[model samples]
Target: MDRRLPVSPATPLIDRFGRQITYLRLSVTDRCDLRCVYCMKARPEFLPKADLLTLEELTLVCDAFISRGVTKIRLTGGEPLVRKDVITVIETLGTRIGPAGLDELCLTTNATQLPKYADRIAAAGIRRVNISLDTLEPDVYRRLTRGGDVNVALTGIAAAKRAGLKVKINAVAMAGVNETHLPGLIAWAHGEGHDVSLIEVMPVGEIGADRSAQFLSLENVRAALARQWSLTDLPDNTGGPARYARIAETGGRLGFISPLTGNFCDTCNRVRVTCTGELYTCLGKSGRIDLRQPLREGGRDALDDALDAAMASKPLGHDFDVSPGAAASVDRDMARTGG
Candidate 1:
């Protein structure tokens, strides 16, 4: 039985700055198999399972957003596949894709579980995925992810390709870490028919490391890549912050997401909801509304009110800084806030 609420026309969610909210990055869980150095601590405390919204609750919240004009929903997490019965959430949302409903439904994953769920994910209406892969070298990958096997992720990527799902490799460019190897990684991803996007490491949480040392600006990256390859800017956007370019040498598209060096908040059209149903209007700011209580206590009407409140409180921009010896912009880790 389809338990999702019917999508109906409603006034679109527009922030004070007039940016219409069309994209929702909803985190299904805070639990993950690998603890990346930049995302979380090696021995981070996991969120209590009881604190997370149930699959039914998640679906209802999504449907409410759909009714209010959210067209693109990206399921994120501390590895969303680690959540039990996540496919149920995916399948439910899959039915909502059409002219009258969602324009696209996608997820960001580490690709460790793609080998197990790729076919099922494709069948559930997900046409593409963004895989977080920072390094291709085995030892460096293991050290970065704290015991994760690169081979497993590679196998998962292959499985995703075989299942007919478009894959995009998302690498966090860190100074002195994977900076030297990124060219090879990009070429390999392009050779494998996958688009690649390099992201500047964000200071989201206290990972016990100096973020300034890790922060690799995309401006420097592009200049270096330009010297090696003929790069041409493209007017391509995937409803996110990435700026794309065509790598003429590989005949592939490359993207740069520079939240620090480049402020993308002017065109920001998305908000995030954590697994616990906390709605964050801006990722770099700590302001959030508790949608779980309203949804659980007062149902759809209350949920709608909370949504409106979120839009009204949406900040025009984020305040992310990665200066030397600087603290994290927000107290919450990327996993808790959604990756």
Candidate 2:
């Protein structure tokens, strides 16, 4: 029996499929320091500074969702920590959102700049963080991230942990690429006192990313971990959709987010707000309600009406099929989508 709350017409965010939207992914900036092959095109064109939502505008947009029962907000971007005044933004939103029963205020980052901001983030009321790193080996890391310093991310992770924030690691497990190193990645994260999540490479856009070539199944990853130690499921964490498990022998935890192979759309309860203020009901599909224009026009009623339209048209499930000839592609890449 499903234990989820029943979808209600009175609910401001319940979609047509009876799923109540409670989570929001807010992208602070589309600018990133590193260019990973899977997430960006070579020499990617980033969003200009003027295109981003001001802190005031973002707060107004968030208030609309909070009033409607949205409880979780995760700041994501090409790299959230890179944005100027991010700590100030987090401080503002975190202080305001929590009193209204918002469960979490978190940020996702590549962690290159986290060493500088981790302490400030903790002071700003962000108690949790998600770090994006694909490998532990410095050389492979540099190769995959296109000249990124693995040591810098490691230092940042240490900083995050020392700041008393809970850290979780996200790794994109691409076959024939990082597949063989999954165990090592998990072990490293566990050693660092963090639960590591292996994400299947999503088919978002074509930046020379061959989904069929890089896609790896979570079931296979689960089996491989089983060979090393006892693996058992743990309760799901808020802010992200990864299903976690306990590594019995080592006393570590592992998580798997297989969006392509394991569709969790039936219980999907999240929406995304892009850097440019486009509200996306589904990450893998394209149906956006522009909040930038109305938001800039500055009227409470206009914002409310836009939010209602988005809620009404919220998708039940994405039309993303990994099967050949039936697959769908998102109009924007992961950077633009707040992934």
Candidate 3:
């Protein structure tokens, strides 16, 4: 005999899909130091402080989500560390949940400022860090980032390592643009004791149309690597939703994120909060629920309602099959959209 009971639409916590919303990607600010060509065309005006979510308001929204089963929180942005008093934000959230209570509290930064803030970050109870480093050559770095200091970024990675934080390097693979140095970057990360994530060039922001020229899938990259090195699945290191494999001769690991050719949406468990407080269920979607208006009007109840709507609207998967021109027309610039 079965003893399971049916759930009602009035269920207080779970969403329509029965997937517990347990992760929140909070974008602290839309401002960034580097204007990476793929991320933005030019420097953008800083969003007015009044328009952005205040610390108190952000905490309230986070609390609402936490109450509904959100256990992991990540701080992101055009570059999260660029915001002032960011440490205060981290500390305030840390007080709500003990170090072990929250399943994970992580962050993603470009790493230009990480070297200086690494210690403060570790002290604030942040455990995981992902630094974006696409190229090893200084000239190539300048070309991609539109004149970013590659040396500074490298130094920041080293500082994070010294601070005892779990660090990962995110390399956005673009063919003819840093593809030749892919192996070298992986080997360097391995030697430095950091995890390397090779991601497919995803067409997500206002520049999605331009992706046709810059975007390259991970399939070609995997084939190239396989020919040069023997890969074996790593033991006991199952990265949720993504595969982690090891190279035979190297003491390093490689990660391939193939969203174009292969999709992992079935296991997707993340929700993004725009800097202006809009909640987006999927990264590829143009629609988002504006929480700012409701939050300013009704407080906690409003936040809960907004979160519920976002979870309910979570799509089954993203459609990159849409023409690049069409994709760009619908979405905001990547920096503004919190990619």
Candidate 4:
């Protein structure tokens, strides 16, 4: 069974709405060192190692997407660095970056294990990394991540900088938790020459907490910051849903990903693949297409067919709601959904 996709290019993955899918967020593992309150439960039931797609299979999938015109691949996970030999995955994908292949290869990590792998990550051709740092207060960080260390994450950020990897901070804005600290966090991140994006809590998985209570709209966040800092809108698109603004005070960029307050579905150009090879066309939707079975059972043709099916079924937008007492729009945790 030859599982490799042909080197020739295929038709671009364009949805019914006419948006070309050029980005893929591939999760290598669902396991993480910290259980962020908004992402997962304190004690999550991780999938068995045998259930995940093998490294070879992952590469095959990447090749398939690249053949179909997906140019940017972002490695994501509960924590991508926690995946064993993840650098190998990065290195494999890095080879695809060129004029005729992928334009960029990057990663999104919680940064707990980054200090150990930053140099290797940079060497593997990852020029930029998006690090998750919700709060700078040690106590608040511990409370949000369920016993995780903030200093460790800080050290990882420093290491990533030392390795010459551009850093971007992703902070999930919570109403009472990190609301007040966000200003200072943004200032500090900007001062350190790192971009920061503030995200509103999405109704993705049930983590035994009231999401409505935790939900802090980016509208409010931006308004609050406007009072303190001069924010001028910027026309920068990072191939994601985030809307960018330049802070006049910090002379830094700030992004806002408001899945609830602002719907970014009309221009969505990406898809997420779980570690188990499940393709999620929309993060706020539960619909999925299984690519692992096709790759294993029918090889390249079957996998390409599955990818086409996924693009066809890609929804116009997600229906994420954080209204009081509303259940999660998607029951899968952000960890399992590729962050």
Candidate 5:
């Protein structure tokens, strides 16, 4: 292991491979309101409240990361909105970390719970909102999310836009499930003044165990869209390897996150932390630092050293591309992981 760590606290915390770690995806809670089949099992075993990180502890962790060059922080979860006091958690982190050089605070949600809190979340200092809506058709949406109401999600999206929050829709395109709805999904989001990105169904978690049939390549979907519309490549700086293109006719835009097809690992610049506190260096590969233990026993300096040591071993890429879509067979449930 390299004994040297980044000397400049203002610079990004660089790993052994020289990737600057600027983004931190923190999962505040593991409980969700809806059961997305592709994400987790229908009835997931929720973590005990005592085991999850508290708001103050999360703030401390964020402060530590910000000092080590984590500028962007995104709150994720099984469905973060389900957590009581979530708004306060968002506000606390945003308020405490902003002056310390935290550049952006964002969250990924199912939108099922957003209508009630979208305005407040925006006011809480969330710069952008990523809505996870796999399909636009109510029936298909219900089928995919197992009884989720698309109208409520649409209402939330409207509320988010009205609140002046930059909104993006993340759709996980599955074969025979949502592949046919790609064009419509993009059209609907675009019509609503939001850009939409289609992600290939990942083979992760127990839900991913038998998902070979569900995997749909974004490449194929892009090809189909190209047949109908003239697509223009657009520059994307969202800090992820997702490629963006403009739909020439509708003046809309679409992003494709081809993790399996292209393995964006070379450009990987983020890390994830489960609500229970395991810091995952890579979403698709193994090896994580026991952040909960360290955060509980070690305090700031100990946490810093632990993070530096673990990040040094961050993998170059994942093996998902080894089998394209089915190779990365992760047993950890997506709900439990800070996905």
Candidate 6:
């Protein structure tokens, strides 16, 4: 181990392979209202409350990350709003870290619990909202989610848009599952002034395990859409989160998350901290640096050193491209990992 750290807090913190760590994805809670089959097992159990990082500890960690060049922060959850005093947690973090410190603050939600709290969340300084809508058809939605209410999620999405939040819909494009609804979802969200993204179903964990038949690549879906719509490449950004373009003249835009197709792993700058306080350097790979133990034993400085170590330890890129067999064999559950 080199054990060399970033020399200055002002310099963008570069990892061992020189990847700059700029974004931090924080999972507020592991508890969720719906049991999405992709994210969890049927009737999956929850992480004990005691194991989760308290609001105060989360805030302290965010402060330290921001100081070391983490300019963006996104709060995630098994269902973030389901956490008690959720809005307050948002307010506390937002007030403590603003654009001066943290350039962007956002959240990823399933939208089931969003209708009740969208306005409150927007008012609390959330910059954008990414709602996960796998399918627009109610029957298929229920089938995929196992028991979630489609109407409830739609209502929440409407509330989020009405609240003036930048809204984006995330759909997992699974073959023979929700892929058929892609065109309709694109049309719907475009008409409503929202961006829709089609993500390839990741072969992670136990739910989609051994179910290779369900995987759908971006190329297959793109070829399907290219017949009707002429697509153009939108300008790329440093973060490379969304690869977006307009849908001809319909005023609706589409995005493709081609993680499997092109492997954007080289530029991956994110570090995910699960609700249980484990810091994950890459979403697709495993093994985390434990921050909770350091936080409990040594206060804020220890937390800072942990952040520094994690940023330095991030890999140049994931091994998915070179070792396709290993990518399929990796077995961490997405829900527990806060995907």
For all predicted structures, in order, the TM-scores are 0.98, 0.93, 0.90, 0.98, 0.93, 0.92
Candidate 4 stretches with Cα past 4 Å from truth are: 1-4
lDDT of 6 by residue, 191-225 (tens): 88988888876665666334456678888998899
For 56-121, candidate 4 gives per-residue lDDT tens digits of: 888899999989999999999989888787777788888888987898899999888888999998
Put down candidate 2 lDDT per residue, 1-339, tens digits, no spaces: 111122223346777777888888899888899989888887888888898898667766776676678888888998987888777778777775456547778889988887798888888778888899899888889988989999999999999999999998999988778878878888878887898888987778666655676678888878877998899888867546788899886678888898877888888889999989999998887889999888667565677678889878987777565454434378588887888
lDDT of 1 at 299: 74
| Global lDDT scores for all candidate models | 0.94, 0.81, 0.76, 0.91, 0.81, 0.78
Best-matching candidate per TM-score = 1
Clashes of each: 0, 0, 0, 0, 0, 0
What residue pairs are clashing in model 1? none
Predicted candidate 3 versus true structure: per-residue lDDT over 167-219, tens digit per residue? 88889998679999899998888888888888877776664236766667788
Off by over 4 Å in 5: 1-11, 96-100, 321-328
lDDT of 1 by residue, 157-236 (tens): 99999999999999999999999999999999999999999999998988889999999999999999999999999999
Steric clash pairs (candidate 4)? none
TM-score, candidate number 5: 0.93
lDDT of 4: 0.91
Residue 242's lDDT within candidate 6 is: 64
lDDT measured at residue 58 in model 1 versus the true structure, 0 to 100:
94
lDDT of 3 at 78: 90
Quality of model 1 by C-alpha lDDT? 0.94
